[model samples]
Target: MIDPIVMIVTMLIVGQIAVSVPILFAKANKSALNLPLAIFLVAIGALALNPIIASMAPNWYALYTALAFPALFMLCPSLWFYVEGLTADTKWQLQKKQAWHFILVAPALIISVMILMLPKETHTAIFIDDTEVSGWFVSLILVSMLIMMLLWLSQCVYTLIKIVRRLSHYRKRLKDLFSNNENKELKWINWLLFIAVCTWIISLITVFSSSLLDQFLFNGTTEALFSLILIWSLIHFGMQQQPALVTDEISPKVKNELIETLDNNKNEQSKASKTALPTKKYQRSALSKEQSKRIADKINTVMQSEHLYLDASLSLHKLAQHLDISPNYISQTLNQTLTTNFFDFVNQWRIEAAKPKILANEATILDIALDVGFNARSSFYKAFKQVTGQTPSDFRKAHQT
Candidate 1:
């Protein structure tokens, strides 16, 4: 009989997939991540189904063993694909070249089939009763399975590490591109990948040790439980995540400016190093005092005339796009010349804009707050107090005739 705990966990896995798959498809956004997620669910579900398969048809255990390896092989590939989709600037689609990623799955399937296609006694001995076969064929099969498992484990680890590195790079990229990236940071995925690594490690331990396998089916049960959590967390959190692609977020003219900035960055890439320089104070190396003053003046002019601060979503990168300036240069100009950061600089304008609204007393405080590009009432109050030395109500009452 299949272990009840394993059975329960497997059922939970099935239930999670049943609910999540439909929701994922129904959602209009982040559909790029759906295919990889679907593939991952299918792979996990197939593995979880093994206990049921073993119970119902003991005689057909050979066939289950044959297919399970290939299913297992799909897990890492699916994960890598999901990360690729999640991090892409535009909607991700499978290209003809990416077909090679699944090349191992076919071979794994064929090997399983070939083993099952062996003589009846050989197949039975290999799949059902290993003690009955002490031949070279059985030894060869054992070695091959061991080798395959090791390779699969290696690939899973490699892909997971790549995901970590990619996520790190993405975080740095976001920092460079946006003044406020609280919403765009993908830290949840890091936790997900960590859990996956733990799951994979537990699976490997359970597979190699016969004593552990005999005591309790923790391997399958743990995997099923973790898979359930992973899927649920993904569905709940993943749906809320918005893409942070520069091309999608900015206009065509802004995109052209960004492209030029990128081209200039490429030119500077060779001379730059990742090493951190000693932190003292802002220094103007290539940017002269006159150039810095010009940039700072231009920034004030643009912010006042164009009312760029009215965009609640504006960032250093977005502002750079507007002025056809590189974000690095913009940051330098703001710090060295203007002696202000992006947050204070933008909020200063927002505070100035709020003054007229407060004086007029035409709209409610909340409405005025939102209209002046403050997303939250609390944020507006905080910035207003910081800038004006008085609350909105106090400021309005004091100015009233």
Candidate 2:
């Protein structure tokens, strides 16, 4: 029988690796936060730590200096990848320099190990650990890990902050481009990064704090952190693999873009609009271009006139009645020409409209969301994110910048 604790930890590591494979193989949105690469590196690095430790064999204590030394460098790759993915609106790219972030730090990492291997007589003792390991050496390793961890955490925090700053800009752009006000806080963008930060902080607290420990504290902290890693794996790793899409909330413009893109004669994929492939099937419609446009124009008028999007219950059926068109026609026109369904198309405008209101800072996100026609803050939030890509709090942060 497998030891539950060890097996669980092993599975957590495996899940992290498995989660990103689909994203790497499937058609993923180019502008996405590169979950595949980040998770891949993190999974490998996390798993590699133990093996590297095992390699320290025979030398035993000497292995900490050798194997544990390079672990710091290993850790940096996943973090940098995640941050770059989060911050960039376009698909992420690693600059040549970025490609070498780990490499550049390697020399220091090796030096730290060598310092750890130095005779205790060579340096003053700081704290006593088992064996004759000098305080200076252990302190150096601990300090290095602490510094790197802080650096990683800081970058992750700053990237999300930058994304939040773009919220106001999204509002201004959407208002002029599409006159709707439903999305307030771009939910996806904020929530994912927010969760990432929270999870990372928890990991940091667990992992780094373990460095200060001796045998007793190390055992408890490692187990606790491993437990957290297990829990986090169940959640975040699962999410990364599936890449939950707010398809219903996606705007017609984006959907239209996708449809047009898929049908286009271009042999090579254009980087024009970052998009993932659509595996979901859609039916072909009999509606003509002229008929679809006419229908859309009428709906647009009603949308602006009654501000229908603010009504959270609004749907193609409800709006079709107002347009004096059949629901089939409404859906057909929306699918064929607009490239998105009625729900998302209208809600996109609503979210766009909600941006400015969120910016006013007078209304809370929940209040502004309702004022704009959302039934619940979560729905408003989901739509807002599906369309614009920021959260209400971040949206507020963007305009202030």
Candidate 3:
């Protein structure tokens, strides 16, 4: 009788390959994430095929093992690259520095080659018969597997920490760069990470447990189920996620200037922290208090006169363009003078505009939300409550009564 677990894993491998084809071939609205994501799925599917091949087709198992074991080293790095692609401010391409992430693969490849070159009886004793085999080669293979497993575990922990930090920085950057960040937050990735952590925990348990417990949970079924969930969620969310920064919208000169200014600011902050000196953000900024005040006034004049807050698509770059100022300066003025980010500053104006409309109660809440530069009612409600300390309906009821 065919084991149900083998059947499930087989289906999963097929599903992963099936989904990856469309992603790999997708040409419309191409993203840097596409190739990494496809590779990630295929790598995972290859890993999933390991046991099925071992048991069902023992002849091909050595070749499959040679390929799949090495692929374990690529899993976490592929995931890291995908997150990096998502959070990158510019076009993300693989950098030469990242090649080191796959260094562990070399040892796994060496061990796999040894397995292929091993004597037929020895290979059969180790992999097929599951009989006790003790020799220098056997010891070497066992030690290598143990070392690779530990390295893979360490890679998982490190990748998770890096991804968490990267997501934090990405969110902060979004606040600085955008007015309304509805779908760009990538919260789904957080849930995906949570699922991934849970899956890793299960794998750890399986790895360290006795043979009895391993039979029940470590037989690939539990991990396969979790993998299925994680991959499906990634596919669903990744396909819809647009690049965080729409670099094409800003001209190359402006984009280069903004990137340079931001990089310089980061370098300055790093130096300041190292020096243990108390320095205000943008302390090196040439925008003096006088200039800041002038800029602030100009900003208010333009906002009040032009009502730019009513445009849901307004962004820091767009505002900077309107005032014929650099985006870095606008960001600095907003942070240093106004004590708010571009997102909160614009949203506050939007909420203020929404207040009178809510009081008038002439239109539906959703209609009012759309009128005041909110693309969605949920966002409008959240902002309204944040500014007013009451929900829109509750505020309306209190004021009207």
lDDT of 1 by residue, 1-401 (tens): 77788788778777777777667666525465777777777777777777777787777777777877798989888878877777665567767798877777876876787787677777766665555577776677778787887788788778888888777766645543443455577778877877777776676677656555455445566776776677667666776776574466567666554444333322122112212431122332466668878999999999889898888788777787688876667765655555555667788898899999999989989898788787778778888999999999999999988
Q: For residues 84-203, write the lDDT of model 2, one tens digit per residue.
A: 453332335556676555653566566556666666544223212334444665667657666765665565555456556555443332222222334333344455455555545665
Candidate 1's displacement at residue 109, Å, is 2.5
After superposition on all C-alphas, the RMSD of every candidate to the true structure, in Å, is 7.4, 13.5, 3.6
User: What's the residue-level lDDT of 256 in candidate 3?
Assistant: 78
* Clash number for each model: 0, 17, 0
TM-score of each: 0.69, 0.42, 0.88
Q: Which residue pairs show collisions in model 1?
A: none
Q: What's the lDDT for all of these models?
A: 0.71, 0.52, 0.80
Per-residue lDDT over 15-81 for candidate 3, one digit per residue giving the tens place of the 0 to 100 score: 8678664766584246656767777777878877766777688788767867888888888888899
RMSD of 2: 13.5
Model 3, position 32: C-alpha lDDT score:
59
Instruction: Sort the candidates on lDDT, descending order.
Output: 3, 1, 2
